[model samples]
Target: MALTDDVTSCLIDNNKLFKDIIYTAQYTATSANHLGYNDSSKHNSSSNSSNSSNSKPLPPCFDLKDAYRTQAFATTTVPHDIENPSVKRIQRRLVDKFLLTMRSFISSLLSLPILALLVSVAIYKTTVLHLQSSGDQRHHSMDEKKEALDELLSQDETYYIRRWGYACDTHQVLTPDGYILKMHRIYKKGPPEPSQGAKDTKKKPPVLLGHGLFQCSGAFVLNEEKSLAFMLVDAGYDVWVGNNRSIAGFGHISLSHKDHEYWNWGLKELGVYDFCSMVDHVKVHSQVDKVAYIGHSQGNAQAFVALSLCPEIADSLSCFIALAPAVYAGELVKNFPLSLLIGLNDWFYTLLFGNGCFLPIMSVAQQIIGPKIFCFMAYSMFSYLFNWWDHHWLRRRKAKYFQFTPRPVSVRLISDWISGWGRQGVLLYVQSPPPPPPPQQQQDGYRATSMTTTTVSSMPLPLSAVGSKRKLPLVVFYGTADYLVDGQKFVEKVQTCNPFPMLDLVHVERLEGYEHMDTIWGHDNHITTYPIILDQLSKVSYP
Candidate 1:
């Protein structure tokens, strides 16, 4: 971005005159079906000027050493309707109507579940009112009926902490870039009793758990007593689960929900700023020089970014474990429905709400009413997109899901991934002007010349971590039947990424019966995955 553009954006941000759409996304394809290549023009012209004189050569597959030697973001523009204003307008309007129709339709489909849950509560309430069998039920009968069910579904961080008996503490960690994220910590196992001596009086080595895309720390504990976060506390690791910046309940210290700047961030910031800062905070608080890192789903994406972009912190990591990791977007067209949805992500987003926050209302609704049709719709979409779910496990834990799953995330981030180019071989500007003056500055004239793009010539890896002399321990775990990840292909891509990747040791664990989320939330993760994870962490510590 030009210094002048920075000044102008800062001015706009201060006066709040800017629109929230991702302007840089003009290169975004009309349809998501374009092979996941970012347009070649996305890189800063100046950064790639020398190569501009000669036709650019094709990039190799994602070799960390070869990922982004020059500042370039490669992208391939698909057949979008942006060039025709009239058609674009029609497209967006048509899409908006369709989305509304779909939402209403989904509500109709999911209403059965909602109605069933509501009716059950009503019956329980009526029965208690008449029989007065238990004191707790009698007290409940007196409270307003409508408010009771809403309140039941809307439990917060504190409620879960108390319910499972985990010792809890809260921390507000400020990022270098000035975003203040609220973080939750578990120092001891729950069912807190006077005789509970499980927690070591001395601080244990820190272990940070990052939630999945759109989700908060709640996912780690949705299974209640059997949750991963609670289990970690039992194992004597000081557990910290964080809510990344773009999540529903999260916000930057300076940016308001209303500020366009709040929408400026994508997945990059979630990893580069949010996850990294929280790691620093935990180290200082626990006085532990190294910590174990576990990322579930997209959380793994952020950790990969941390290991790649911030090489200086390599030694700070004792180990990196990814559960249901989604590091590659290779051969996505194979998963036609998911690819199509992602391919048209931008168009649908444009049609639905034109580049601001994605589903902000849904975020609020989930919090206020707890789980409802909207949450059901979101989860159902996932079930269709990735069908390896163990039906039996879900049926057993059915009640916990509605109240716990479906986190709100920015559509911009989701759109980026669907683009394919965004995650696989994305290149970005090497230099950006100093961050615009905070909310206080009024500024003017900046022309951004960076033309970012993405190309998946190789598997994704950080330049530094790819070649690190001090290897970070890495364990990649996945569910065998998960379409979200091409399990076999991922292994092949990793082996081809480098002759020897920087990790001191790498282990790939693929399990049957488990799907994407089961690695972390399965009732038996303690029996299946946790032992491997703990064993890996122990190896790192002992080594």
Candidate 2:
């Protein structure tokens, strides 16, 4: 923002300077014309005609002096004309000056980004040197210091995971729609030995962890041992971390990231294709009929759409754990600037961010600035935008938290999310038909009416419509203080509407003072958040 202000100020000052220069040139020409310099050219022309051999061209100052004398002595004066050679020369000089100024302005404007990059590089180098010096002085081994530096500087999730003494394996799964997403599996660092825990590892149920918007799978593993991924691993669950399309790196089977078609997807596609494909892959890999699923914010939103619309994939989840689920506009978003921005048309949004990935340059900036500076900028931006204080964040590992996130997502995806804020009720991928009326309502010609209702005809009927069918367990952990999305309001709406009977056994826990990000990064979350998740995961009956 400071950089933007500096550039704006520069432009404004240059505009004022250009206006002043134009005014001075105009004033000088007008003064010359008032002194009768326009007639001097004709006066000189006639003289030159009469004494062609004797006459030489008058100096430029001579014309002004001759004009002043004629203006005082003669009875009439000639009007200013653009065709005057003297005036033309002056105009050409003015044009040349203006062009020179513009060239300088353009060069400076172009160099601002380059200057910012150079500064970022300088800071990065200085930080690297400082870390190396600190590492040498510290009691830790060289490998440990290297690991710490790698976690601070690397963009890969596996580096973060392995840095904390956890094993990480990267798996690429192909979605039906041609998007190849990356997933990370976290486990004990060493190979499985003939121990009791190692023997039981194969028997453990697999758990899939999905990150929030603009975040990759690395978000859950940033806090080292305190991170949700490591906690899950410690809790004897096989943890699989999932990424949405275009995150980390754009991996499409046929389309390039530069192509608009590669990014021509929104939340619906994420849920329908990315989430479903990952679940299927996890099931096949784990050799289980069902896998426990956990999602954060927009991750939960995708799960709601996927589990509600696709019965087969819905059945594949042993339990759906939603942390600070973002399915509706919160109080903060429903007001002021956010509401106004969200109300704009899709074309307007596309114009703002272009048709491709959203803010890909931020990733480049992050790499240049290094994690500490990037983390500070990110925190400041989010704090201002979301009115968050981040009091609960694990401050020691805050830089690492930002090292892996703010990944590239489609502009269409962000636009869709923004559009949803303008409406009331659950955010839907496609407009679903109104749910079937209750049996009593059907018999008496009365129907259920609620703003949050959603029903898919292609999927199996709800449990209310078809009594006592197998239902997907949806466990919700919401923060009372989260203003980005009203998780409490959504939970209440679901309970009141009872629209999704497929999610009949919905469990909701409201954390008293937690914020949106606190669900994942809160201090002592392993004790507060993970235990609840672990308790819920324990209830799932694995096949």
Q: Choose the strongest candidate by TM-score.
A: 2
> Candidate 1's residue-wise lDDT over 1-543, tens digit each?
223333444553443211111121211211211333332333333222222222112221232122221111111011111122221112247787787557544544544464345445544544444356334322223222322132244437657766667667666554433344667888655343353465545445789998876667877776666678887787767899887865534444334545333454455556655776677767766767787889987887777655555555566678888787666543443554555454443333344433445655555665666355544444454455455343324333434564555565655555545443333332231112233333333222212212111211222232343353767777777776565655555454444343224453357676765677778766567667777777776666622
CA lDDT of every candidate? 0.52, 0.62
CA deviation > 4 Å runs, candidate 2: 1-151, 191-202, 430-467
Instruction: List, residue by residue over 340-375, the lDDT tens digit for candidate 2.
Output: 556655444444455556766667777788678788
TM-score of every candidate = 0.61, 0.66
Worst 10 residues of 2 by lDDT: 73-82
Among these predicted structures, which one has the highest lDDT? 2
RMSD, each candidate, Å?
17.4, 26.3
Give the range of the ten consecutive residues with the poorest summed lDDT in model 1.
Answer: 73-82
What TM value does model 1 have? 0.61
